[model samples]
Target: NGVMNLSIKDIQGEMLIVSQFTLQAKTAKGNRPSYIKAAKPDISVPLYEAFCKSMETHLEKEVKTGVFGADMQVALINDGPVTIWMDSKEKDY
Candidate 1:
């Protein structure tokens, strides 16, 4: 079997951690997405923070993050196959 087993430690690039609370959205009832199942920020914030901290520990470096609970706009230019490298030296907007 030509299966490639990879780990986060093997990634030689920066990690961007975004908190997507919409993952818990329930759309079974109606067209509008209901976030009733989502954890409130009071609970989710700590979990999100913990996850980013854990990832930083695993990668042995500080991970980049977006503003929590803010309406943010992200633009991505995915050039190659699954990997997009951004120069970390650039200051975060």
Candidate 2:
């Protein structure tokens, strides 16, 4: 539904996605990140786009995002209905 305007990569191995969808991605080699071998636009891109669509729908709002193909740290914070409204008064922190 959408295209990644950015890129995603792991310089080290410290990146920890709680869902770990990439863990199960198929590859030519054995169990590894298989990033290089990962034919992204062929597979991951569509899925990523679909995820974006479903995600925005589920949230019922336009989720702010970065260019997926761009090198950046990706961490999804699953905050369920944690809506906060700001005002001139400090009624709620």
Winning candidate number (TM-score)? 1
Candidate 1 lDDT over 1-93, as tens digits, reads 523355557757677888777867888988999998889889999999999999998899999998889888876654234654556476857
Q: Give model 2's TM-score versus the native structure.
A: 0.39
The reply for model 2, stretches above 4 Å from the true place, is: 1-33, 36-39, 73-93
Q: Tell me, by lDDT, which candidate is best.
A: 1
Per-residue CA lDDT of model 2 for 1-93, tens digit only, reads 323332222221122212234544566667655555454566866776677776666555565555655656765653244444446656653
Cα TM-score per model: 0.73, 0.39
- Backbone clash pairs for candidate 2 read 5-67, 6-67, 6-68, 6-69, 6-70, 7-68, 7-69, 7-70
> lDDT score of model 2?
0.50
